[model samples]
Target: MAWGANSRSSSRSSFRNSPFSDFGSYMVVKNRKLQEQFNAEASSSSNSCSNSGKPLFHGVSIFVDGFTVPSSQELRGYMLKFGGRFVNYFSRHRVTHIICSNLPDSKIKNLRSFSGGLPVVKPTWVLDSVAANKLLNWVPYQLDQLASETHNQPTLSAFFALKSCAVSVDAATRLTDQMKSEAEDPLLKGGTIKGDNLS
Candidate 1:
């Protein structure tokens, strides 16, 4: 009976020492901290905006993605100041816009597939809207439009087609020029050349 009790105690100790044993406690503590921080920020932001007159972005909420020009922190401050919500995580029902400077093709495709036509706009849209003291039309700030216009880039298929055409034209021109030169050469005009033997 003593040995059985000792074994049970040892087993309990080992289970406590396992890597995942503290995960639940750790997550609880982390979530508490995050909640506290959010509450503090919200109170401060509300205080600051209480006397600032009407909020420009009262109905807007944004989720930032990747690297942004004004940075996520600044955007968060802007949102809070302008009476908008800055979501730290992507929530399809809560997020009204996605702010990003750039996203890779695969990431963009994934976002588009699931985002249900959420407007992906540049950081400039927020800044310019803040400056103008109103929400501007988002059409001109669309990520796809801005990327193509700013980089002077064509669509993938069009780019490949243009490259193939250029290569073909260059090769054909070189072959045509070589044939014309060989035909005009006087020394080989009457000779038939075959496999390094001339007759």
Candidate 2:
């Protein structure tokens, strides 16, 4: 159901539709004293996951039509069951103004139950000094781009695992022309994860 949220109904905007969808009004939190207070208040609450001011839930941008929602909801619930509280990794007490970043449009505000629920401080405060919000918004597009490229490339590594055997020409073809080169070089050059050296 669409609430008072953004109309960009794509997967990127799915959060805009939920009742708890008013994250726009929220900003990333940074004040150490405020976080400490927030943590103290929530520490007694069940299902509360305040990791010394870290938001337990790290939003991963994903897409979903109605049919895709059931699985999403199931996974969401499952994650929350395991203490998946939302977290903003850029907290200040960590000796930096920010840590890992998100998207650029990331707002710096908090949106919670203006009615009566315990207010949820947005983690934007810490996320500010970086592209964290921008990264958040960019992730989906990047993954989609990767998948599209993966579908178009050709290689042999795709078929072989660390066991040093081949799977299929189509699969391996995807490894080089499809997946590897598709990613930014810095990422590919970083380590074995991107390098075929795994096998």
Candidate 3:
């Protein structure tokens, strides 16, 4: 019974010393460090922005989608500095604007279907607003506008196809006109050229 107890104690000790056991503690420490770093950066940016008078994005909260030009981290810093809310995860109720460089037509349609007319603007809107020290109209920066414009414009292949068809029609018209003119010519008659002999 004593030997059995000792064996059990050794197994417990071995389990405690296992590499897998350290993973949980390591994750906790890492998370804590990341939280502290984030807090420090946020506070510093907010402090700097506070010195610049009123926050440009005071009441606005934005959610970023996919990849962006200035990167999510840089945008987060800008939001903190300008007194805007930057949500890590997207929530329609909490987010006032969606920032994205580009979204596919399907994704744009999906967003429009459920986004309830949420203003999806480019990152330049934020940057330009920061530069101007005032929020610019989001209409000019709307992603849907771009999508609509692209949809309305003819594609390269379609344009080329139309041009080719026009050219073919013009060539056919010219050939028909030449045939009529040749038949009407008094110098040539009975399927004979003016300069040719029928032998």
**How high is the CA lDDT of each candidate model?**
0.79, 0.34, 0.79
Candidate with better TM-score, 1 vs 2: 1
Expressed as tens digits, the lDDT of each residue in 1-199 for candidate 2 is 6674445556455665644445533433334444455355445444423343433333321211123223534433422432332222322223111111222222211211111222111233222212242222322333232334447865566544633544465578877776657465655555535535554
**How many collisions per candidate?**
0, 40, 0
TM-score (C-alpha, index-matched) for candidate 3: 0.52
TM-score of each: 0.54, 0.19, 0.52
Candidate 3: what lDDT?
A: 0.79
The runs of at least 3 residues in candidate 1 whose Cα sits more than 4 Å from the true structure, single-residue gaps closed, are 1-36, 46-53, 145-199
Worst 10 residues of 1 by lDDT: 45-54
Candidate 3: tens digits of C-alpha lDDT, residues 106-181 = 8877877777778889999999988887878998888855557657989999999999999999999999999899
Candidate order, lDDT descending: 1, 3, 2
Better of 1 and 2 by lDDT: 1
